[model samples]
Target: MSTDSMERTLERTRRRFIRRQRTQRWLRWRAILAVAVALLLVAGAVWTVFFSSLLAVQAVDVEGTSLLSPAQVRSAAAITPGDPLARVDLARIEGRLMALAPVKDVEVTREWPDRILIVVSERVAVAAVPVGSGFKGIDADGVLFRDFAAQPKNLPLIVLPDDIGQDAMKEGADVIAALPTELQARIDHVEVESVDGISLVLDDEKVVVWGSAERSADKARVLDALLNAAPRASTYDVSAPGQPTTSD
Candidate 1:
């Protein structure tokens, strides 16, 4: 080929390569600019949310608790509507609610856009244990809740073991429910010597040696039979099956 023709061909090839590289560079710049714009838009939206309005609790919802008023439960949760959801911690709210004496358990869930829901489980009073001036209401699991305003007339008074404290108060309640209604009525108070044994002091001053928690219902039945066969003020000892002993 001629030198002039060869030089012209090389120049054309170089020009084409430069044009293609420019197009590619332009495409990369455009993509980067578009991503930057999108990120700025997201940042603006987030900033508006955090600063445009006063961050305060706006609304609160409570569930799973009937005994406590919504206001009470919400107060316990220490959360409200209008509060910045970002700073609103569900764990801290749940912890505060659970700290209340009446609340047994609590769960906090965030309903996005502006709402907080607090679900709660209140302690269930299983029975009452006599204390000074009033009776301590024990929950289903034997945890002591609160003292009644006045002595509960219909509620059975349980005598808990000294070590039972507030937690084991429920055990005494379970034993009370295990006893037969007829035998339960003749009793003034039940004595718990360790959750292991339960003794009943009847109106007639007779002692029921109901040793251990085993066969409590059956043992109570035996006491009923003995009472029917005997008179008031009779001591009916039922520590053993088929060996009920009565004393004057």
Candidate 2:
């Protein structure tokens, strides 16, 4: 081969090598750029799920509170501000709220990205029992929750022995609750001897033998009929509602 032909062949080989190098460098940079972009996208998703302010709790909404103020319910929940709403433990917050004496039921939930909602149902007092010089309020479910300096006027007084168990107190409360509103308003107090033995005394000192909590609706009906028939009875017995008796 001539020298000029050899030089031209060498020049063609050098150009081909340079082209290959440029292509490899471009591919390597593209791969690195793709990896960096993927890492950035994953990091952004993680921050949104676990650390972003847009997804953090900004407000706590409380509802169904009467006896307990909103502040009291919020204090019981104890959820920290700016915590991730998706990661909030609803069951833990509900358990905390239930620890309050008057709370009957509670529901906790997350409201989208920025809020948590708490709903509470509080127990209501149906009767009052003497505790030393003051009184303790008892709900219809027989939970003695509140202590008052004075006896509340509308609620009936519960009279049970000092050694009386919760079952007997619940029985007496059930008896009072079964009565009609008019009859309930007339009740001055309730007496419990045992779970199966319950009684009611009216405001005028008229006595009723209500027996156990069972068959209460029947007893209430019979007692209402008996009282209406004999308006001035001093004693009413409806333990056997089918054969009720009234006596002076």
Candidate 3:
């Protein structure tokens, strides 16, 4: 090719390359600017969340405190006004409140915007038992709830040994269910020696002994015969099923 023609072609190619580079630079700048703006917006959103007035607890709604006072529960929850409701650790709050003697269960939940709610079910005693200090009416789970000198509620008394555990409570319920209607009504208190051995102290001060958790239905039926035998007895042994023996 001629020298003049080759030089002209080289200059035109150089101009086109420079223009393309500028265009590429402008596009790159636009992309960088967009990314920076997005990052700024995300940072602002986080800041707003961390410092928003909505996080403060404006009110507290407490429910399920029939036996316990709402004010008392609120105090126990430690969720007062001006606290950070959004940052409230529910697990911690529930744990703290559950330590109360009267509380069986406790729950805490957020009420959105600026509120906190707490719900609690106080323990109800089904029977009284002797603990360290004195006799206390305990719940079905064998948890000590209320003190009882003679009788707290109209519920039947449960006489358990000092070594009795939660299993004894379950054994008591089972024995109560197996007893006859008439005999069950007359039963004022149930004394369990162990899961393997149980006794019923009737209102008439008679002791009905149950041998074990096995053959419960047969043992309960024979108890009626032993009670009606017209012979004053010290212990009615229902452990032997049909052949119940009494010891005076």
Tens-digit lDDT track for model 1 on 1-248? 99999999999999999999999999999999999999999998777566444434477878887777898887777764566766788888887887777788888886766678788888876557877777787665667667787757666667875566543454566767787666667678878766556677876668877776567778878877887887663567787868888887
Top TM-score: which candidate number? 2
Name the top lDDT candidate.
2
Residues 29-82 of candidate 2 have per-residue lDDT tens digits of: 999999999999999988897877879999999999877889989998999999
Model 3: lowest-lDDT 10 consecutive positions? 45-54
User: Which runs in model 3 stand beyond 4 Å of their true positions?
Assistant: 1-23, 130-135, 147-150, 159-184, 192-198, 211-234, 239-244
Alpha-carbon lDDT, every model: 0.74, 0.89, 0.77
Higher-lDDT candidate of 1 and 2: 2
State the number of backbone clashes in model 1.
12
Give the alpha carbon lDDT tens digit for every residue of 1-248 in model 3. 99999999999999999999999999999999999999999987665555556577898889888767888888888875776666778898898899888899988999877888888888876556656656776675657766656665456667787677778766775666566677767887887887767788877787877866567788877877777784598788887887788888
Model 2 accuracy (lDDT, Cα): 0.89
**Candidate rank order under lDDT:** 2, 3, 1
